[model samples]
Target: MGASSNEAEEINDWELPNGEENKKIEEPQETTEVCARMDALGKLSSLIRNWEQNDVLTAVAVVGAVTTMAMAYSCF
Candidate 1:
């Protein structure tokens, strides 16, 4: 005894019977952090914001990058 052909065709219903397939992913409440990295990033953000207010931070950043690059090339 086997399922009739009609029973096989009915299994192809387009939706799950109660919308179970439409569920969304939920955000997790906890996350891992590196305290040192977080602190450095916070300080950097503060410096940028202070620069925005005082108007010399961008120039300082450019100088800082040039200085770092010069030092790196000198080392090699």
Candidate 2:
């Protein structure tokens, strides 16, 4: 009974200190921003890669028009 009684108190007090708790909980702000930028850049990069893969980027005229459309879409 005595050993069993101590278990609840011990478990109740088991906690990482406040600083460590904050360190664990409050991370990922910079990581989140970096990941978002990486995602946007990856999307644009993949589009370029696809254009190249399909023999689309070889033409300067089409490249110009596509880039203009991209710029307009992104701005709006």
Candidate 3:
């Protein structure tokens, strides 16, 4: 069904009263920045993925042991 006049007017108000031209200009730049971010994140993730699970677990255990030892020594 066709929009009633009030509904049509409300829809028009929901559309940008201004800045449509600016958004059209910025869209490509926004997309490019997002893609660059995604690429960097993928590279970072791959670096982390290169670490073996055993290595990560051992590192975590070492840190935890160090923290526990420090806390115990501080109790003196």
What TM-scores do the predictions have?
0.30, 0.32, 0.44
TM-score of 1: 0.30
Best-fitting candidate, measured by lDDT?
3
**Which scores better on TM-score, 2 or 3?**
3
lDDT of 2 by residue, 1-76 (tens): 3557678777665667653322234554567789999999999998877675447645877889899999999999
- Encode model 3's per-residue lDDT on 1-76: one tens digit a residue: 8999999877665646674522334443468889999999999999889999998999999999999999999998
Candidate 3 accuracy as TM-score: 0.44
Pairs in steric clash, model 1 = none
Measured by C-alpha RMSD in angstroms, how accurate is candidate 1? 8.0
Question: Listing every candidate in turn, what is its Cα RMSD in Å to the true structure after a full C-alpha superposition?
Answer: 8.0, 11.7, 10.1
Native-vs-model 3 lDDT?
0.83
- What is the lDDT for 40 in model 3? 100
Error of 2 at 61 (Å): 1.8
User: Which portions of model 2 show Cα errors greater than 4 Å?
Assistant: 1-29, 53-59, 62-76
Lowest-sum lDDT 10-residue window in model 2: 19-28
